[model samples]
Target: MLEQLSSVFFDEANELLDNLESQLLTLGDNPNDSETIAAVFRAMHTIKGSAAMFGFTDISSFTHEAESAMDQVRNGVIPVTGELIDLLLKARDHIRNLLDAGAEVPENYKQVSEQLIIAFKIYVSKNGGNASLNQPVKKDVPKIKKEDKLSFSWRIKFRPSKNIMKNGTRPELLIKELTEMGTATVVPFYHALAPLSEIDSELCYFSWDVILTTGKSENDIKDVFIFLDDESKVEIEKIDLLPGENNRIGEILVDRKDVSREELDKILKEHRQLGVILVDKNMVSEEQVQSALAEQQHLKSLTPGGQVATPQSPASTQTLRISSAKLDQLVDLVGELVTFNARLEQEAQEKNIAVFKSLSEQCGRVVVLMRDVSMGLRMVPVSTLFSRFRRTVHDLAAQLGKHIEMATVGAETELDKTVIEKLNDPLLHLVRNSVDHGIEMPEDRVAAGKTSVGTVTLSAKHAGAFIMITVKDDGKGLDRDVIRAKGIQRGLISENDNLSDNEIYNLIFQPGFSTAKSVTSISGRGVGLDVVKKDISTLSGTVSIETEKGMGTTFILKIPLTLAIIDGMLVTIDNAKYVVPLNAISECIAYSMPAEEKGQRFVTTTNHGKPLNCINLREFFNFGKEPPAKQEILSVYDGDEVYGLVVDKILGSQQTVIKPLGPLYGNCVGINSSSILGDGSVALILDVYQLTGLIKNSSKKAS
Candidate 1:
């Protein structure tokens, strides 16, 4: 159980670290951004609490110091500074290292942790921002006007996580912690407990309703719940009672939201004590009425004869955190359902039964809809990727002594989680390239008549079934001559090869290719762009560049939205089936390329216009059988290049659940994955980019 919870803790810890990095970068820019500041504090606080709970004492102790500094920063006792931000950022990385290192942290790492702890401690030590090793946490207490220091009354509903006891949390410790503030009456609710045989010793079945009279504000009370996870229910409300003998029970029940106002009014019509009526009518649980009565009695004592209930509002919709592994399992099940539906259609066709055919069609629609929803569950906003690179840009800028900022557009564009995961390395490389090489330094930028701060824009948007992600920078663009020289020096291309400017730029992706004058800490070693190419290609994607000599460069990646499924246009070549992504095809024509107008690897229309790079599927794959009398031409595109894919015949569209061809066909060109046909035969999914490689550059396109 500890092992399982530790896994969840690490996952959550990583997410919090990502959030922390992003928030810290934001706070670095806008020092007075209170919300971001508080977010950093909350993240640190949660990590500290969770780490302490999980027995990661070193991590808990280390993060506590950072949290203390942040708390003082939160209280406005300490100011945000670049040095402080730098310290916190280092601390964040240390926490991540600790999490990654697992149960044990090394002695040297402990020293590093202590170093950061001291730095955070000293950074906030000035102006009583917690200089001491044992400074008590100061709550944001409200000043009471009454003679009694404990002038505020609060109702706290706390339900510990079911596994809290298993995790070794003591409820008495919590209650004891709470009593430090002032008076707290904790009424334990055991109504949720089952009979002895049914109860699990490891599980916690208790909740509490605490009526506390204190001068502390809501924030102060919230601090007591640092032990709880986000899913735990902890509602804190302040009581504003008035002095009166006629303090209404029905009002208290309604305000507590244990009973609706309508139910209270309706129950009052019977007037046999509102609590008893509510419990007997089953308007609320007996425990709820008793808790309301507890509040009623507590408030009456405060006001000498009255109890006032604070108004409660509906809570936000809850979100469940299911691991991606479960989502993948669901999608795999959906894929099976799709295959099963296809089998139904095939059986219906073979029998030529009208009823079965109708049923198959209905089931097919349902499967397609269900498939869409299941896949949609895996589609997350690209902002998750975009926000992550902000730190990359921030750190690189500081390292390189450049003024750089990130701008994003269409961040809400969604893509499959698998694609997004694979995209991380490629995106990281591109973003680093943009910062290291693409974005010019401040002085150089000013001299070049651009802004002092270079901007790297990361944007993503949907284009049909593909997602187009652009990493653009406002900096000195690629020097084609330098790239050409590097390509020649590396033997990737000869000097007399006469490469186009675009081709010259693409040579940067060649292994061992570099335009850097010398090796540096970042990109000068000549290995980043090739990774971008290799990764994007594995996803059956393509990359292209757009640049102007003095302006900037943009690396555009066009990748399929999902690897699991596609609305493919199935085609036939030599009686063998293939699936072309329907979204990739512009149109299909029923005319062959005029033999006389055909170039080496391209074909021209009847009008004999510019040649379109064409790949004859039959000839490209060298199929045994010949094509039919008539052939079809699929006008498709890769990036901005228009191309034609020639096929024997179009077999219409299919809901293709793309399956990997496995290692045997891993090296196969023009085919990346396969889909199961209705009759249970495998149809290869055509990769347009790979097929484009089969088509040599045409004279018409070059000119």
Candidate 2:
């Protein structure tokens, strides 16, 4: 199959740009780290090279300028500084815009590009020496002359590190790129690998003996190992040629002067370094160095731009360049499989045959495996989402003139690609808000007996089946009095009404709410935090805040692992059916009969708890029909506490594919999204958090 290589380039370029922006911002704070300097250099290098391949000529050209600057930092020719970092950030954004232009040249983008170049050159002039910031014009990259080329033949042996794949390089892709360089033949060397029982999937154990004949110099071949030089073992040597040079490897080697008579005799006697014998004896000239370098770079580019040496595993996997559409199709197939498995199992039980029943059980196992494989395809690390916030926090902190440090944990946590995509904007807003509004100024922090450097921690971890992503900041915590006063002024609450701390903190998420004494460009727009809450809740997730008077504040978001599918607890209320995410259900118990007080009945106690207020399903719906004498109360937890919701009956569990509620139901409260049952019934997925909010609001109004 003809592989589309540019997609990988785009994906990688984007990731590098994100890393570049984040690291540059961080370097602005601490510019002395040699490690971070190298990181910035690598990110720029990858973006520049990949952008070239994807036909992002302007991005490649523009990013080359930044890469040139970063390369100087990497080599210690220039010192990292705040001014340098700021200029690099502007450069990063411009490169991003260029990449975003994708195969088209957008009008006025050139002007933006020129502006960025001027800013970068100015910073270079200021922070860099007068020996000429823009004074040293970049030299054009040298290229080989194909027609005048002298081809050489050699046997190259390569064994990559175990983590080459993890580093985003596939040996298959490397091999393919190598083949593109010249006439090549590959012989896979699988002799040294351990048995399957002792293998590690992360390791690359196999090696290859390649016979390649290319007009490119040996240096050209060696350059291919640049990024992998630290991580793998590679050896290339010229060999003697046979009579028919064009027809066979042996003949080609003889023509290249790789295997001398002495070397061949030594091979007959005892083998010696073939390339050494040929080159040291002046058989190959200084000109060969150029081709060798080109070939080497060509080879190195096939691997990841950066890697480190590691052990190999017996199970070497191959990477296929599959289109994302194929993955979507696979996921759809798996979804259908799950539905059919449910149907088959249901039918088998009716047949009551042991043989068919056993087959159904086996099919169930296969279905589970297929579902996992499909889900894995959609599982992208949350690290991308988390890494993005680093830049946001850094830029906003600098803008707001706060000394805040961001610490992230559990970044390796995985979530659905769709979830990650939708989560980025909301997460960005939250981190920005924390950096601007949550963290106190360095002087204020010191006065409060706290460290001068405040902290914003972005963390993700699995709590049961749900992923909890929390943004916690150490600053002057939320002031309840300020929020309460604002609420009264806005008529969201009565002046004398009593409210809990949680309620007061949550008011900040109300639309058109702001407690800032004076609005600033960075925040206090009165629209950001509320949008964050709405966006999160739209994912069937819950957002809550915790704060201490002088310590800090935390905004915790609880989201499901995937939105495409979920395990839902089916229930009925009146004539309407509803689905509650099984992950949120703490338990379900029979609601005890209760006495009526003012035309309302409440469940006093069911499971060793105090009298908990519950609404009769029929009465809550105002169905005008008598409520079911018996009720099943589902206890749902919203990350903080649990509440029982009364329903008519539990109709078992289902795999529900979430469907967004259309604009017509835009104002519907308590219903987060709708999903389709296998039986073609539309089940309204209840937002337990919203439902609890409804109960709280109703009780407050009554009191």
Q: Pick the candidate with the highest lDDT.
A: 1
Question: 265-336, model 2: which lDDT tens digit per residue?
Answer: 554343455444445667654334233333343333221211221324545355555667787778877777
In the range 127-151, model 1's lDDT, one tens digit per residue, is 4665864465754553223443445
lDDT of 1: 0.81
Per model, state how many residue pairs clash. Answer: 0, 31
lDDT, candidate 2, at 472: 92
TM-scores of the models, in the order given: 0.73, 0.66
- The lowest-lDDT stretch of 10 consecutive residues in candidate 2 is 301-310
- Which ranges of candidate 2 are over 4 A from the true structure? 1-8, 50-57, 102-329, 340-363, 494-498, 571-578, 585-637, 642-651, 663-671, 690-703
The per-residue C-alpha lDDT of model 1 at residue 518 equals 82
Superposed Cα deviation of residue 105, candidate 1 (Å): 2.2
